[model samples]
Target: MVKTKIAVLVSGGGTNLQALLDAQREGVLTDGEIVLVISSNDSAYALTRAAQAGVPAVVCSRKALGSQAAFEAAISQALSDHGVELLVLAGFMSILSADFTSRWPRRILNVHPSLIPAFCGKGFYGLKVHQAALDYGVKVTGATVHFVNEVPDGGEILLQKAVEIQPGDTPETLQRRVMEQAEWKLLPQATQMISEEIRREKDQ
Candidate 1:
């Protein structure tokens, strides 16, 4: 099927990564095979998930590597080793430089926990995004899957699903809701969409 070789970059609990694994198990992710997982933290739970799924995983800790450049270099080398064709940032914490993004162009994807252009960009991640949405009194918050570019969260969006903000929603509650209703579903869908695109391009 010429499935796209995918590498998931993660930094913490890999709920999103687990979603991709589950999608593959159920045949929802037909055009993409998750070949590797690269984690920025050595102790991240995502590694355990990857091990259980039998996916090869590696860690390139920013602190242990001692610099962002070295950390990225390690990740680049691993991706090269695996011949990864697509990169997915699933709760990945590092900010990739322009040099790195340029190397992959539209081949990188990120799932941000917001509708984007809303509670995104610098200082917007994890629970902070949901807190910002609640602070602004927004009735709806969601997730956005986009192509990663130089700017933070400033990439061409691929998909988004609006999750309603409840009356008594806290940041934790809202974050969970967004993941349940949006991130998990959209990440796999966007992955398949891009995987199919890559397969077609490769065929031609």
Candidate 2:
């Protein structure tokens, strides 16, 4: 079977990207190969992670591009050039425009720190989502993997795993637990599922 070419977009530490890499190394991502890693920040550690994994990494700084259209165009061009069949927003901070999302359709996927329709959407990212969940005193909060649409975090849900909110859990500890128990497990599983589906479609 031909492996689906995957490109992961990141802007920060890229723990999720590392999870994918680890999964690939362990033969968990059987139907997909992480071909490229793109960073919106030039100095993002994700680029270093990609380098260590021998995956091609590119920096297309949104600030340097100065316009959403130009940045999206550059990203689209990169995806095209690399023959990327699937796009994963691992820790990508920039919000993609409708033009970009529409161009790829359901080919893009994202992993949110919380269940969608809760601590998601605009202004909720990274630690903010976990902070909101803890502030709200929710007994349960976890990770979600979904298809990326135009709206932020407003995508078709694929997989979600709930983590029990401990009594003494702070945002930091909760975030770490969620990444370990949920994001790391779900992202790779969802990616493999999507890759297998894409392979089946091609075979048909």
Candidate 3:
């Protein structure tokens, strides 16, 4: 069986990266193997996680790049150089433009911290999402993994898992719950699905 070469993009603590790594080690993630991790922040703990995993990681600081185009180009160059066949935006903060996204089409994946169509879009991310959901008084919130497209969090949905909003749940608590119950489980599963798809196509 062929394993799809994967690269994870991150900008913060690599809890999601750790999940995928744990899954891979546990044999739950069989169809893909993470080969690289890219971070927008050089100081991000995600880079350390990558190092501990023995996965190559590169830093492309947007502040240093001086522009979104330059930043994305640097990232693209790194990805291309590494021969990354599958891209996973685990917690990558920078928004990619249509030009960059178009090259990968459905080959890229992102896990948004919301159920999608709700608490999702350009301005919604991280704790802001959970805050909005709690502010809106929604009883349910979860996570969504989707194919990357030009629109932020507007891509085709691959998988979603619902986590209930508990009584008096703060945004931080909800975010943690959503990550553990939804994001952690869903990402690896989606990775498996996409990886299997890619492998099947490759083996053909």
Candidate 4:
């Protein structure tokens, strides 16, 4: 069985990346192997995590590039150079261009901190999603793994798991719970689903 080559894009600490790495090591990712880790920020600790795991890491700093197009091009080139079959956005902050999304379509996946459509869309990301959910007083908040499209968080949902919002739950606390319970679990499961589907298709 051929394993699909996956490239993870990150901007910060890469907790999600770590989860995927752990899953891959445990053989949970199933027919998908994380081949490369790319970061939009040079100082992102995600690169360090990838290096520690003995995975190739690359930096395509958005700040260093003159334009958004250039930055997108660099990312695209990196994916192509690595022969990535799937792209996973793990705490990656940069908004990819429509051209890039169109090129990849459902081949790209992202794990958002909220169930989406409630604490999602433009201007809602990272802790902001949890903050908005907390401000809205939602009793249940969770994570979502969805295919990447042109619109932000506007894609076909693959998996979602709700995390109960306890009393006195701050955004930080809620974020931690969601990451531990939902994001970590759902991302790997969703990736495995895609990988298995690809394998089945190839077999047929």
Pick by TM-score: which candidate is best? 1
Q: Give the top-scoring candidate (lDDT).
A: 1
- Go through the candidates in order and give the C-alpha RMSD of each one to the true structure: 0.6, 0.7, 0.8, 0.9
Record all residue pairs in model 1 with backbone atoms less than 3 Å apart, i.e. clashing: none
Give per-residue CA lDDT, model 2, range 1-204, as digits (tens): 798999999999989999999999999999999999999999888889999999998889878999898899899889989999999999899999887888877789999999887899999998899999999988999999999988999989999999989988888999999999999999999999998888888889
For residue 15, model 4's alpha carbon misses the true position, in angstroms, by 0.4
Each prediction's TM-score against the native? 0.99, 0.98, 0.98, 0.97
RMSD of 2: 0.7
In model 1, which range of ten residues has the least summed lDDT? 116-125
Candidate 3 accuracy as lDDT: 0.93
Candidate 2 regions exceeding 4 Å error are: none
Q: Runs in model 1 with CA error above 4 Å?
A: none
Q: Mind giving the per-residue lDDT tens digits that candidate 4 earns over 29-59?
A: 9789999999988999998999999999999
lDDT of 1 by residue, 1-204 (tens): 789999999999999999999999999999999999999989999999999999999999989999989989999999999999999999999999999999998999999999988999988999999999999999999999999999999999999999999999999999999999999999999999999999999999
RMSD of 1: 0.6
Clashes of each: 0, 0, 0, 0
